[model samples]
Structures are given as structure tokens and as C-alpha cells.
Target: MTMTTDMTNSTAPVKPGTLFGIPVGELGWFASLLMGTAVGFAAFFAATFVGIISIMAINTIGHHAIDYSLAYKRIGLPIGLLVIAVAYAYLATLWTKRILRKA
Candidate 1:
């Protein structure tokens, strides 16, 4: 068996990427909020679906009953809210600073 690997040069210069003439690091707060909202919305639906599946599996295999509302009210809501808040905060901090520096 022969093995090969690509080596990276530490001294090589790296370039920052840009979009629409704006650097990636300088994404705006509205963009951040939009991204967060999208993620949170997805998470909410995913969590709800998973939770319901788990509950159904339990009901079938263990003869245990779980309220479907628990998925949305407890598991899904908290996860979605947390994701949205964290994502928005992180992106806002990174993008908003560019504005302050310019002003």
C-alpha cells in the first residue's frame, strides 16, 4: 500500500474572501439576523420532528405515552431560541465593529 499526503506551507500568504465588494469579515447585522432566523427556524422544525419520532418509537417499543406538545413546548422552543440568539449575537459583534471603526 502506498500513502501520500499534501503538505501545507506555513509561510504561504492567505487571502481574505469578499462578497459584493465587501469583505467576508465585514458582514452586516441585518445579514446576521437573517442567517440566525433561518437557522433557528430550521432547528425548530428539526427538533420538533425528532422529538415526535422519539416519542412515537417509545410508545411503540415500550408502551409508554408521551404528549406531542412536549416536543414543541419544551425541546424545540428552547433550542430554536438559543440558536437564534447565539447566532445573531456572534455575527452582530463581528460585523458591527467594522462600522464603529469607520465612524
Candidate 2:
């Protein structure tokens, strides 16, 4: 029986230049930072909108059961907002990585 040992490493070292067809590297870091900040701002705006809607709903529906439901809805807002934030962050990271690969 002949045994073959795995000797080849498939992972390639990151080169400083174009990566995945986009120009990046150090510049990519700055771009990613900017993108993250922009996404954060957008998330904040969305959260604010949701908050306003929740407040209006609470004001309009003054029943006890409705108020309890509103509280539950408000609790969901933060989770939804967090999901959005994480998705945005992931997208930004992916974009940055692609750009870096190209650069």
C-alpha cells in the first residue's frame, strides 16, 4: 500500500495590488471605514423612523391590550435594527475585501 502525504498549500498569500477586479489595499481600509460609517448613519435613520411609527401607533391605540402589544413591538424593533446593522456591516466587509483583492 502506497500512502501519499498532503504537501501542497492551496491558500495564496495576499498581494498588494488589484484584488477580485477592484483596486484596493490600504485605500480599501479607508473606503470600508467610510462605508461602515455611512451604513451606521442609515441604520440610525431607519431606527428613528421605526421609533416614530411605534410612538404614533401607541398614541393612536390607547387600549391596554394594544399597549401591551405595542411594548412587544418595540422590543422587536431593536432586534430588527440589530439584524440590519449586522447585515450592513457584513456587506461592507465583503465589499472591502473584494476591492482589496482587486487593488
Candidate 3:
């Protein structure tokens, strides 16, 4: 029986004009940074909105009011939004890599 190696360079070929090993196609770092940041902020706001709605719904079900002031003061929403934003930024950067790769 013939044995085959798993770590072969038989992967798909890479296109030209890639930055950071990502096929961004001559995209500058500054632009990509801004794009990533925008994506992060978008995710942050979207997640925050959904979280707030969910919190309000849950609190209402228990006959409790949503304490907006306490929520912000406790940094719950802020922390969660920050984490989601960072994750989105990372995904956006990864998506950018795929953008030019397909072109």
C-alpha cells in the first residue's frame, strides 16, 4: 500500500498583489484599518441594540424595569460591545483577505 503525505503544497494557488498574505490587491494599510474599524463599530452598535432589546424584554417579563443607567455604569453593555466589535473587526479583516483572492 502506498502512503501519502498530508502536508502537501497542493493547496489552491495564491493570486498576485497580496498584503499580509491576504489578497487585498494594492489596498493600503490605512484604508484597511479604517474599514476594519468601521466594521467593528457597526457590529458594536448592532449587538448593543439587540442586547438592549433582549434585556428589556427579559426584565419586563419579570415585571422589572430596564436600568439603563446601571447597565452603563456597570460596564456590561460596553464590555460586551467591545468584545463583539473586536470580533467583527477580525472577521472583516479576514473577509478582506477573501475579497481580492476571488477576483
Candidate 4:
């Protein structure tokens, strides 16, 4: 007599922390720090780009030309993006924890 068993399926789900397809926990502390910092900087630059475009649009619609008069206006975007990045990183980590709990 012979007995057969299937081992191809898992009874419990697996959860892994990921950001942009990179397993967050698998990367050691230094690598994770680098990845997070890169994400933060990219977010900041993207926000700056959007801000510039917004300012240009406002100036063009209001005065029919590009205007670069306010320095404070330019500063807001980077600050806002920094906040967003921090919140995003924090939330992402929290989310990872929640997902891991399901495993």
C-alpha cells in the first residue's frame, strides 16, 4: 500500500512588507534607510515640480506671463512634501505591521 499527500498548498497566508516590490524588512537597516531617504527626496522633487507648474499656471492666467516674484511660495512645496513623505513612511511601516499580523 502507498499513501499520497499534497504539499503544494499553504493553509496559512504569508504576508511580507513591500515598497515598490522591494521587501522592506529583507533590506537591513542601512539599506532600508537609504531606500526611505530616496523615496523622501523623490517625493520632495515631485512636489516641487507640481508647485512650479501651479505657480506658472496661476501667473499666466492672472497676468498673462510667468512671474517669479515670491520666494516664500517656492518654499512651501518642499516643506509640504517633506511632511507627506514622513507621514507616508510612517504609515507604510504601520501598514506592514498590520499585514504581518494577518499571517
Top candidate on TM-score is: 1
Q: Write the residue-wise lDDT of candidate 4 on 1-103 in tens digits.
A: 9999887966554445655565564654456566667666666666667667777888877875655433235654556567667846765675566657668
Instruction: Please write out the lDDT profile of model 1 over residues 1-103, one tens digit for every residue.
Output: 9999888766634444343444545666777677769889999999989988988898899988788899999989999999889867766766777777799
Candidate 4, superposed: residue stretches over 4 Å from native: 1-14, 64-103
Question: In candidate 3, what are the lDDT values of residues 77-98, reduced to their tens digit?
Answer: 5665676577556656665776
Q: Please, what are the lDDT tens digits per residue for candidate 2 over residues 1-103?
A: 9999999979766665445744433444557566555656566566656766676677778742344344335654565567557755665667677766789
Ranking by TM-score: 1, 4, 3, 2
Worst 10 residues of 4 by lDDT: 67-76
Largest lDDT belongs to which candidate?
1
Tell me the whole-model lDDT of each prediction, alpha carbons only.
0.78, 0.59, 0.62, 0.62
Q: Decide which is better by lDDT, 1 or 4.
A: 1
Clashes of each: 0, 12, 0, 0
Location of the lowest summed lDDT over 10 successive residues in candidate 3:
68-77
Query: Which ranges of candidate 1 are over 4 A from the true structure?
Result: 1-24
